[model samples]
Target: MTPTITTFTQQRVTVADGVALNVAVGGAGSPVVLLHGFPQTHLMWRHVATDLAADHTVICPDLRGYGDSDKPAATDGRTYAKRTMAADVVALARALGHDRFALAGHDRGALVAVRAGLDHPGAVTHLAALDVLPTLDMWEVMHGTSAAVGFHLYLMAQPPGLPERMIGASADAFFGHFLDGWATDPDAIPADVRAAYLKASREAVPSIVADYRASATVDVEDDQADRLAGHRLRMPVTVLQQDWGTALGFDAAARWRAWAPNLVHNTVSCGHFMAEEDPGEVVKALRGLLSR
Candidate 1:
């Protein structure tokens, strides 16, 4: 069966201090920004964006260094910090004439969403993070061989040049591995989407590695700052995670509660790509979170 996609065109918008980005905007009413995870683009949210667009304006963008967006050379200051990425979302929302918006992000996008909420608590109305814990917790919990689930976190967190070179060598294999491993069903991610993700990741290897490196370095600093300042998410927060805690032996909800004072967290019976693996359930969770 040929699927029909609500064809949206590309529009370039500048953010991250003049780093131009390609964004896909559609629908009307209250604005909701959907951020896609690593090794993928805004296309990851194609199904959810269309469904939410029925009643609320949906703005999905190929985040900087991915998809149709500008792939700037990430340097000392211009690297892919979630803080900078979150700021890009702020600039994107403001450009779209939304002073306050609801945000939902999956996988790596969820990392950025949490940063956005903590940084711009006034601008983000509600926040939902799918399938990830905060960077600090994620790093601290990994040890010896037990942390094999996030092998890339340590690999990409290395000195910038090595990860970029290695990943670039076989970008297709690296990106395709996640698409294949995370999804419960092979058909969940169509071949075209898989191809697009691989192409984008290959093109954005430097920035992607920089993003992960930041997670291990500057991102950790930012999270530590928030922790020291006792900064908690002011907006209502929701977290939908696979039962990694049960599998890995950590209280997922308890960890989230430590950071978010106002929180509703749940574990879903799905794999890592919760949205793609279980779109209907993801939508229901979003509807409930946003409704609150």
Candidate 2:
């Protein structure tokens, strides 16, 4: 059987235009909304969520295009844009009686969290992004041979149909490749959890591809506009990442500092799935962020 966060109640909450998200809510006190990354679901927070729930109200939701949430069709460029997804997160929190909350996300979800912090600064009191650079900086820094590490980004950024079909044809192999390769500790994701992630990704190829496609197009445009307007994250921000900048040839903290003046950037000693591979460290970083 697949595992879930302990002591959390699962529910389906409608966030936008009849689109509902499958979410897990637990604990009391202050509210914190946690978003999961690509090739995975809210289940990625199984350890971290339970730990935080000891004192805070934790909201863990499957992003619209992944897991059990409503997968709306990507009718236009805006459909799966981070702006639209960020609105879904704000709506999810408000529906759960939180006008303002702390927010954290990993991988693709980190992209969404950054958008939420930028677009709804008043709504997100504290922000944490684990293992991802902002969209605009990500596109700017990835160059030449180093770009090969992110081949999936380029693959899914193609013009819709072909990318979707190609990934769909051999979904498990494609998704499992990341699951196998990106982790320094393979045992961090147990066999059943790995299976669950593969199943979710396999079933949501088109929507998943649409999410990445938007990152390449609409998300970049949105970030660029924000940059040109000199907008920055107002809340305190925490960024935990592996030392990818050393290999990618760009100062990760410097790039993040451009958008987040109030930032605490740390290079974690783990893989991309740090929340799973090293949940204790992730929880520690998050707890420190919440206190700030």
Winner by lDDT = 2
TM-score of each: 0.95, 0.98
Candidate 1: tens digits of C-alpha lDDT, residues 1-292: 1122366555778876658877777788899999989888888888888788888888888777777777677768436888888999999899879889999998788999999999899999999999999998888777756799789988998875788889889999998999999887888788887887888888888888888888899888999999999999888898999887876778889889999988999888878877777889888888888888
Q: Rate the local accuracy (lDDT) of all candidates.
A: 0.84, 0.93
lDDT of 2 at 42: 95
Can you give the lDDT of residue 20 in candidate 1? 80
Candidate 2 residues lying further than 4 Å off, grouped into runs, are: 1-3
Backbone clash count, each prediction separately: 0, 0
lDDT of 1 at 137: 84
Residue 129 CA displacement from its true place in model 1, Å: 0.4
lDDT score of residue 184 within candidate 2: 98
Q: Please give the lDDT score at residue 154 for candidate 2.
A: 98
